[model samples]
Target chain A: MHALIQGIILGVLTAGVYALMASGQTLIFGIMKVVNLAQGAMVILGAYLSYQLFTSFGIDPLLAIPITTVAMFILGVAVQLLFLRPLKAEDRSELSLLVTFAVALLLEGIMSVTWKTSVRSINTGYANSSWTVFGYQITLVRLWAFLLSIAALLVLYLLLNRTRFGRAIRATVQNPESARLLGVESSRVSALGFGLGAATAAAAGSVYGLLYPFNSGSHYDLISRLLSIVLLGGLGSIGGAVVGALIVSTSSAVVASAISPSWSEMTFFVILLLVLLIRPQGLFGTTARGAI
Target chain B: MQLHNRLRTTSSLVAGLAAIALVITGCASKGGGGGSTAATSGANGSPLIIGASVSLTGDFSDSGKAVQRGYQLWADTVNAKGGILGRKVQIKIVDDASSPTQVVTNYQNLINKDHVDLTFGPFSTLLTIPASQVAKRYGYAFLAPAGGGPDVFKQNLTNFFFVQPAPTTQSGDVFANWILSLSPADRPKTAAYAELDDPFSAPIAENIRTKFEAAGIQTVYKQVYPSETQDLSPVMAAIAAKHPDVIIGGTQSVDAYAQIKALVQLKYSPKFMFQSNGANSPLEYPNKVGAGNTTGVMSSADWFPGSKASGSDAFTADYTKKFGGTAQQVDDNSAEAYATGQLIEAVAAKTGKLDNATIISSLHSGSWPTVLGDLSWGANGAPTGEFNLVQWQGGKLLPVYPSGVSQAAPVFPKPNWGG
Candidate 1:
């Protein structure tokens, strides 16, 4: 029972970070129907940026998110403008796959050349610090990262629900031609939406660097997980992505704690397979257009 | 016109694929004369081409690149020394990106298309079998730095030679031997083991278990997780709950850092901890896990920076001069590569020829002096030396096993994590 509870606590803390990473992937798909294959690369780039700032200037990764997010936002806009925007509407979704993959490869090459192939981990003063709650250990860094994820999600919710620009984004996602006729400037929305997606990746990347040992090539592992989460969440639903993350994290954690870690890795892919069989649209996903 | 346009696009696509292939093939020095096999001299006075496919961009990219550095340094050193047999040594390395299929294709290309005089092995046991098969078909020696999985020896390919000190499975036996050497009271009463489901890592855990259990060290927990298993905290928690006195981490790559960090997070500090392949490289290990946290953590290896082996000093000097790191930064993989080069050089000098049949016959008989001590191979191409055990003490990865080579004794009931 104690082990079960501990796994739950761990799963919930880890889910927050996964939700944040998957949210950006879903957001890009919702806005432009162009799956951002390079979302993982953007997140890794953000990690490298945070790693640089922390190593060079002694800035905490949590504090460097603002700078990383802004810089990543500009890079994301440029990617959308330079590579993605050129595709004709009829071929945009199909062709964006190839273009974004190319961008990912390009980013991977650039990162590899800059930071040779080696494993790097960011160790803060509290890297091993933890707190005991009711005979269960909860790491301090994980707790802070979880809280930060919640705050970031709340801000994302506000941006999508409360602002005029948010409404424009939703309108463009729903009916591009209608939104353009209604003076929404769909192209601008698409660019900003892509940038916002990359910004979210940057936020999540900072937390990821704190949590894992990584290198320039680490994005390959992340892309599969992000894609699975997005698919299990029904393509472009943010709330569904969170729930998918919860299922993915908790099922594997509980099984690992209860059974064996060897079997735990299979639990998530199994659950995903079963979930897709039962409800192709996912838990919170709708058959209609996506919303944040 | 439409049919002509479609035909033109298809041709362009084919031409683009060829260009990409050319880029991969020409990764090392380029514009060479016609290729030659090991049995023949370079055509029209071309350099002796040694071709390889390394994992440059994928899962094995880290170790693959280290292997590449070893091969590159050896080639450069050989060329500087008046070119082996009056011909320059030029190495052509292509990126296999860590794919087993890609490695096979690369070996085929190296032998058939490029006709490289000699072929080197790729990164893992998973790759070496397929790669050595290609080398065997073409009758060229496949001297490799890594890929010492027992399965490679099972194939019994005469063309293949593993340059490391010993087979990887025996690494665990070395650690177990050290534990048995300690006084019964000093040794841990309870031990736990964890490993990745890797051809290289899984056997180490099993081998250690056999030795430890026979010595009456009760195993409280063990888990063999897949290589892609995420969220290691739960596994660490499971081990923590068992509260073993010692931990045997059978990890090959950087996952050792992950396992240690997870234990730290769980607040579970064992009496002693050791790993199979991790913590050997000072450049990476201490940085990933804090230098303080690494104290007293034992790791087994095939080589270290402090070795007084033949030509080791020169290898270190050349590595530092070329790579611009300190002498200590000279990695074990690069040493293995240079040693393979030494083995080939010995074969060439002894036989007064570079034929594959002579090379294979020579390797089976005589000992080859290398940076990792004078190495001798059995008929199966497995080396005769044993893996050395090292520990982090006083901010250094000092040799702690084989009394002849050990600089320091291992700390028992190792001080608390980062204490």
Candidate 2:
């Protein structure tokens, strides 16, 4: 029983970070109708940047989040402008897969040359430090990571729903032609939306580096999971991503605590299959636009 | 009219027969030359191309990178002294990306495109499988830095050699023997856990089980978990119920580390020993979790710092001076890679020719002195399998067994809760 309770706490904390990462993926899909396969690579790039800053300049990874996010935002804008923006709008939805895959490969190559493909963990003093609350031990780093993820998600929510740019983005997603006539430049909105998506990755990346050991190729595995979460959440919905992350994380954790640890990873896939079988789209996904 | 007819018929028959002969010869050459290019390259007098297919990216990336670094370090040292036998040696490296398909592709590319004379590869067992197949098919000499399965040797690839002892051989026979030698009162009940379907992990887990039984410590339970498992609750609970004297884990460093953390949180006090692979990581286990938390845990590996016996001190000094830190983890692969560099130089110096067959034969016939000891190959051109057992003592790795190599007494009564 204690194990189960502790597992739930762990699951919730883990879900927060996954939610942040999945939100970025969903946002990109929402704005451009492109899956943005390079989202994971961008996250890894963010981690590497944070690692460099922490190691070389004595900056804390958590503290470096703002700098990393802004840098990644610019990179995201550049990628959309240079690589993604040029594609014909009619052909974009499918062609973006190949383009994004190429971008992932390019990022991998660059990281390989710079870091030499070695596994690195950003070891902060508080990485393993934990505290016991109600007979459940909580790692300080994990707790911090969860809180930071939530804070980032909240910021993203405000940016998307409460601002002029947010309204333009919504208009484009709902009606591309109508949004353009209302003095909304669809291209500029997409570029900013892509930047925002990448900014989320940087925020999550800082936390991710604290929680896991990573290398250049880590993005391959990470991207797959993020895709799963975004798809489950109804592709374009940020709220859907949060709900999807919580469900996946909680189930896996509960299984790990209740049943065999070995079955936990498989359980997520099983649940995903079962859910998709019943709904076909996702929990919150609409067959027409929001789901893949 | 009769002379003209005779002349035309004779010339036509001669031309037809000559064309038939040429076509037959061409067909025969193309069919017979399929694998001969690979064989001929193996026998060629050109600089021996030692192909290395290694994990340049992923979890095992650092180990693979370190192995490559050591290999190149050996090569550079040899070349600077003088070209190996007046012939410059070249090493071709292919990054396998730690995937099986990529490993096969890289191995084929190395043999087909690079036309490598000899090959060394594949730091892990999974990647080694396909890489070795390519060597066996091409008839090129292949040496693996860190692949040895009991069944792998059973395949009997004539040109393929494993330079390290089998996972079972190293952990099962030697380490277990030492544990069993401990007095009956000190012996504890044991249980083992491993990641199922992992070739290197399963054998070690099985070997530990057998050895623990021999020591009269009955195993209450044994379990295999999926590779993707992040939590170890079920197995830990089953083992906890058994209340075994010790728990042996056959897993990677990350999994082992995570399990230990979980176990500590659950407050289960079983004497823990991680399997050989996870135990050998250069990273300090005790430092990862404070010394007090990691005490009484035992692990064995190819190299340990506490062993003043044999080449331990020299390797530590040389590696520290060059790499700016102590050589915490020096496995058979690392030492062999260093030795390979030296051996190639030695052979090249004596022969002065870079013939593939000559280098392979020379390496097979002679014994090479290495930091680990005399690494002499048997008739099969594989290292005479030898290993050293080490235990973690107060956050320091010290050689404990193989009585001849031990520098410190085994920390018996393993400092417990109050220590």
- The candidate 2 chain B region of ten consecutive residues with least summed lDDT is B1-10
TM-score of chain A of each: 0.97, 0.96
Q: What is the C-alpha RMSD of each candidate to the true structure, in Å?
A: 8.1, 11.5
lDDT of 1 by residue, B1-419 (tens): 00000012233343344445445654542444222234453343568778899889777776677788988998988888977777788889999987666776787687667777888878776667667766765567778777787767887887778887777677667788888998988899999898877766778788999999999999998888877775678888888888899999888666788888888788788988988767676777878878888888888776688777777787888889988888778767778877878887777777776667777778888788888767778877787777778899978998888776788888877877776
lDDT at residue A144 of model 2 (Cα atoms): 92
Q: Which candidate is the best by DockQ?
A: 1
Tell me the tens digit of each residue's lDDT in model 2 across A1-292: 6556766777787899899999998888888898899999999999999989988997889999999999999999999999999999999999999999999999999997999775666866666566777656676777898999989999888877899988888888777788899899999999998898999999898888877767788898889888888777778888889998998787777776656666777788887888888987677776665321
Residue A46, model 2: lDDT of 91
Off by over 4 Å in 1: A83-99, A171-183, B1-144, B157-161, B341-369
lDDT of 2 by residue, B238-312 (tens): 455456666777665656665665555445666645554555444556544445655556566554554443344
The DockQ figures for the candidates are 0.53, 0.21
Native contacts present in each candidate (fraction): 0.69, 0.21
